[model samples]
Target: MSKGWWAVVAVAAATAACAKVEAPAASDAWIRLAAVPGRPAAGYFTLHGGRADTKLVGVSVASVPRVELHLSRMTVGDMMTMDATPAVDLPAGAALPFAPGGRHAMLFDVPPALTPGKTATMTFRFADGQTAAAEAKVVSAGASGPE
Candidate 1:
C-alpha cells in the first residue's frame, strides 16, 4: 500500500476510536397521579441502556418539585416497603424497567395541572453525564399504566 493510503487508514481508525457512544433512552414512560390528593405521584418507564454500561443517577421533572428513585420490595411478614435508591446500574443494551411494585420514581409535589391524558417531560440523568428526556403520559391513579 502507498504511504498516503496508510496515513488515511490510521486517521480513520483514530476517528472511529474516538466516536461517542449512544446515549441512554427511555420508553413506555407514564406518570400515575396519586389516588388521593396531597400524595406523591408515581412514574414508570423502561430505560434502555446505551452502547456502554452506565448508572442511572437521577430523574427530574420541571413541573414537579422533587423526584427520587425508589425500589419496592416485599419484606418479611408479607409487608411491602419502598426504599430510596441512589443509583441503578444499567448494563450495555439492557432494558431496566420501572413499574409498579418494583423500581419507580416518586414524584413529590406534583402540580395539580398534571391531569390524565396530559404529558410531562422527565429527564433521566446518567453517570456518564448524559441526559435523556422523554415525555410521560399522565394517567389516573386507577389506570393500569402504559401497555
Candidate 2:
C-alpha cells in the first residue's frame, strides 16, 4: 500500500467516525390519561435523554389550552400539595418518569370530551431549544405503564 493511499484511508475512517449520528434527546415518551370527569386532567409520561443533558421546559397541546409542570409535594402541614415546577431535568441516558401523585403534567382547559381511546398530540419544548412531539392516549383512571 502506498503512503498516499494509507493517508486517504485514515482520513476516510476519521470522517466516518465523526459523522456518527446522535439519538434524539427524548424517546419512548408517552402519556396516560385520568378517568375522572369534568375536572382538570393529568398526564404522565417518560422523558428519555440522549448524550447531552436536557430539560423539559414546557408542553403544549391543542386539546388543552394550558399545560403546567407540577410536582406533588408533602408540605410541613403533612398535607400533599401541588406546585409548579420550572423545568424537569434530563440527564444523559436517563429516563424521567412523570406519574400520578408525583411529578406530572397538569393539563388545564382540556376539551370537554377527552375520553378513552382518543389521543392528544403534545409537543414538548426542551432546554436546548429543540421540540419533540408525543401522542398521549387516554386511559382509565389509575392506569400505569413502562408496560
Candidate 3:
C-alpha cells in the first residue's frame, strides 16, 4: 500500500528471483578399478544436496553401457546382496554417501581406457529435469575412493 512497503516488496522479490535453487552437486567422484578389464566397475561419490529437495532419476557415463544406482545390504541373516534401484531421493542440505560396500553406482561394461589416472564425465539427471555433471576419476584397483 505504502511506497516504502512497495519498495521493500520489490527488493525481496528481486532477491528471491536471483537465488535460484539448483540440483545437488556431485563431489569426490571416482571409479574404482575392476580386476578384469571391461568388467563392471563401482563408483563412489558424495552428493551435496541443494537448497531444495530433489530426486536422482538417472545417470550416464561416457564409454559405459549402463549406469544404475545400487545398494548393498544384508539379506537373509548374514548374507549381503546388491540390487538396482530406480532413483535416489535427496533431501535439502543432505549429504548422501556413496562408497564401497555401501550405496554406490554400478558402472556396467566399462572400457579399459577408464583405468587409474584417467577421468570420465558423468551426468546425473534429476526428477525436475535439472542435471548435475561431474568428473569421475579412475582409482587404483585396491583404492577405496578419492582423496
Which numbered prediction scores highest in lDDT against the true structure? 1
Q: Which portions of model 2 show Cα errors greater than 4 Å?
A: 1-36, 142-147
- Most TM-score-accurate candidate: 1
Clashing pairs in 3: none
Off by over 4 Å in 3: 1-14
* Candidate 3 lDDT, 1-147, residue by residue in tens: 899999999999999987977558888888887787766788888888888888888889988889999999998898989999999898989999888888888889887677788999888888878888889998877776665
Residue pairs in clash, model 2: none
lDDT of 1 by residue, 39-94 (tens): 99999999999899999999998789899999999998899999999999999999
lDDT of 2 by residue, 62-110 (tens): 6688889999989999999999998988887787888777888888777
TM-score quality measure for candidate 3: 0.84
Ranking of predictions according to TM-score: 1, 3, 2
Off by over 4 Å in 1: 1-20
Who is ahead in lDDT, 1 or 3? 1
lDDT per model, in order?
A: 0.94, 0.75, 0.85
